[model samples]
Target: MRKLLQPILAVALGLALGLAVTWIAGESPWHVLKILEKGAFGSGYDFGMTLFYTTPLIFTGLSVAVAFHAGLFNIGAEGQLTVGALAAAVVGAVWSGLSAPLAPVVAVLAALLAGTIWGAIPGWLRARRGSHEVINTIMLNFIAAGLTSYVALYLLKNPDSQNPETRPIGPGYLIHQFGIFGGAPVSAALPLAILAAALVWVLLWRTSLGFEIRAVGQSEPAARAAGIDAGRIRIIAMCLAGGLAGLVGVGEVLGNAGKFKVGFSPEFGFIGIAVALLGRNQPAGILAAALLFGALHKGTADLDFETEHVTRELSLILQALVILSVSADGLWSWMKERRRPVIPETAGGVTC
Candidate 1:
């Protein structure tokens, strides 16, 4: 019960704060609410957009969750995702003469490899030089951004095109759309994300390898006593986590854009940490939380289009507010107790 109520409470608090801000700025509170509502679920198309956005979040959130389970904080998901997308774009663009059916399969594999390599670098540093992954990943993000930008702008740039995006992948690389459901733009990658989440959950909880991961995370000395390779496990865990981030790349490029753009992700990897936190690091919870955020992202634009006074970025503010409320859970707990009637202590003649 509490688990469910917490999300409700967070959302309520966030809405209240957002309405207050809008009202103070001389905007209609009800109008903003309507905008948000209509934008997120106005039609089947909107819901499809919600799911399209969510697929990547689930993948990236799971990536962070996996790292957290291993007692490592991976702050470089942006970098991993960037490299993965770049790798996929290159493969899809250059690999020719292959059957159209085999294109997506080969492209996704290329992305996974690039992301794993990027993750392995930090893992190696931590395993060998006792460096912290947090710092290493942060630095790597800058490098990845610069390198990706260079490729998108110069090396991969379509000479005839005006944008800083790469050339479009061949027609065979496109994911088919299901137009019967109100023209939803959902791609094939959504199912892959669901499968990835389920497999990751199984790998973490139901497998012998999962035990080793938990053992290494719980205590290095104890893991050693249990004959687990602590250092190797850490590296493997990082690569595994990075692979999930890479999947986000697959969904975005192969499923959505069908080509690599200079800026593909709108910080999906970054927002995933919040999703992981709200989900309490569980895969099932993460799915729901990711969908909530995904809806917010898709719906916020509608809010702006509906209400000229408001901006779409207000959704980010609401998300931040929710995170704040969740962080202050202790206050909510105390208030709940305070509002309840006090019960008399039970002992012999306790009422008297």
Candidate 2:
């Protein structure tokens, strides 16, 4: 019960704090909250948009969660996704003549390969040179941005258009949207994301490699003593994490946008960290958390028109507060501990 209640309490506290901020901004918190609720679920279209935003969050959330399971922090999901999207765009554009069914498959494979290689670099450095993954991943993000930018600008740029994006991918490469909400962008990727989550759950709990990864996360020394190659596990975990994140590109580029845009991501990679943390790194929890954040993203779109002082920035504030509240569990426990009275030990078996 405590485990279940913790997240609920944290969410409540975060919303309470967000309401306080809203009051300070000279707005009615209740009104703003109502607007948020209505906008996120007012119609089928609204719900579909929420799911559309959620597809990528699931991938990125799982990417971070998988690395956390291996005691590794992969902050380079942005880079991996960017490069993977570029690869998918290139494959789709240059090989437009491929058969309908084969094009998307090949594009997806290209994305996975690109992301795997990008992720493996930092993993290799960490395993072989004792380099910190956090630093390496951060640096890799910048490199990926520059490299992808150059390719998009110089090589993949559609000669007929001014946008810094590749040409339209072949129709064969596109994933069909369900059109459940009258032409919303929700595509087959939503189901794919859920399937990936299920696969990840099975992989981490039902496989030997998963056991080794968790064992390494618990203690490298113990894992080593037990004949597990901790370094190799970390590297493998990182690669898997990268591949998961790379799927974000498959959804956005191949499924929705049909091309790689220069600034397609709205910091989905970084937002994933909060998702993983709020979800407690559990697959089911990640799904719930992703949906919540997705709702926030979808609802906040109309803030400018709904209120005079409030804007979409309220979403960021709410997200930050939630992260802070969730992370403060330890500090709250520490404070309680400090306030507890120490029991006196009596000498000679005498009690006070």
Candidate 3:
């Protein structure tokens, strides 16, 4: 229960700080809250859009959480998702005469494979070459960006459109959107994301590989001493993380856009870091955190029209504050330890 309360308290602190900022900016915090509430849940369309935004965050959050469990910070989920989405788009656009289930399944597999390969590159570097995963992942992001742009612009450019997007996918590649969303593009991807989260929980808690991954994360040297191949675990964990991030493409390309738009992602991969941190790298917690951030993203859209002093950028500030507040938990613990009274030890080595 104490562990559960930690994240909740941090979130509350962050929200209080954000509202105070709003007050300082000459805006009524109450008005801001009301506007955000209305913008996010005012209509079925609004709520569905929030879920739409949430779907990708779930994938990316799981991606980061998986890598975190393996003692790796996978900063390249953005790159992995970019490459994976392109792979899905290319497969969907070029494949012909395929049936419904087969077409979508093939495209999704392509995404997962591409993401796995992209993630594996850095994982291999860290495991074999003694290179840092963070640096390798960061470099991969730039490479993925440039590579995807070249493909979208030259290789598979939509001839009829001037936008930097691929050709439209086949009809069979398009997933079914829920009518309950009031014509919003909320699709079967939402349920798939939920299923993925559940599967991740099962994988991390109910498997030997998961045990090895967690053991490696706690201490690589100790895992090595226990005869576990730490390098292999790291690589496998990263591969899984990348594949999860790649699933974001399923919702973005097949479910919503039916094409690969260069900037379709509003940094969902990056926002996932915050989600993972707030959730304490737990699957169930991540789901809740993703929804909260998703609502914030959708709700802030109305700030431009509804509020005079506050804008959508306020959401960024709020997100940053939330991350800071959560991070401060470590510092708070350290401070408490420092202030704790020390007991003197006797000559016999017993505490006095």
- CA lDDT, candidate 2, residue 299: 86
Q: Each candidate: RMSD to true structure? A: 5.0, 4.0, 4.0
Give a tens-digit lDDT track for model 1, residues 1-352.
Answer: 9887887777688779978887886789888887777788888888888888898889888888888887788888888898999888877777644556788888888888888888888888898889999999999989998998898888888676787777767667666665644766677788888888899889999998887888888888999998888889889889988888887777777777777887778887788877887777788988988998898888887765677677888878877877777667676766876687756564335324
Residue pairs with clashing backbones, model 2: none
TM-score of each: 0.90, 0.94, 0.94
TM match of model 1 to true structure: 0.90
Measured by C-alpha RMSD in angstroms, how accurate is candidate 3? 4.0
Off by over 4 Å in 2: 335-352
Candidate 2: lDDT over CA atoms? 0.87
User: Comparing candidate 1 with candidate 2, which one achieves the higher TM-score?
Assistant: 2
> Of the candidates shown, which would achieve the greatest lDDT relative to the real structure?
3
lDDT of 3: 0.90
lDDT of 3 by residue, 1-352 (tens): 9778888988888888998998998999999998889888999999999999999999999999999999999998999999999999999989945769899999999999999999999988999999999999999998998999998999999898999999888999988899998988898888998999999999999999889999999999999999999999999999999999988999999999999989788888888888999889999999999999999999988998897888898888888889899888565675565597655553344322
**Which has the better lDDT: candidate 1, or candidate 2?**
2
- True-vs-predicted CA distance for residue 97, candidate 3, Å: 3.5
What TM-score does prediction 2 earn?
0.94
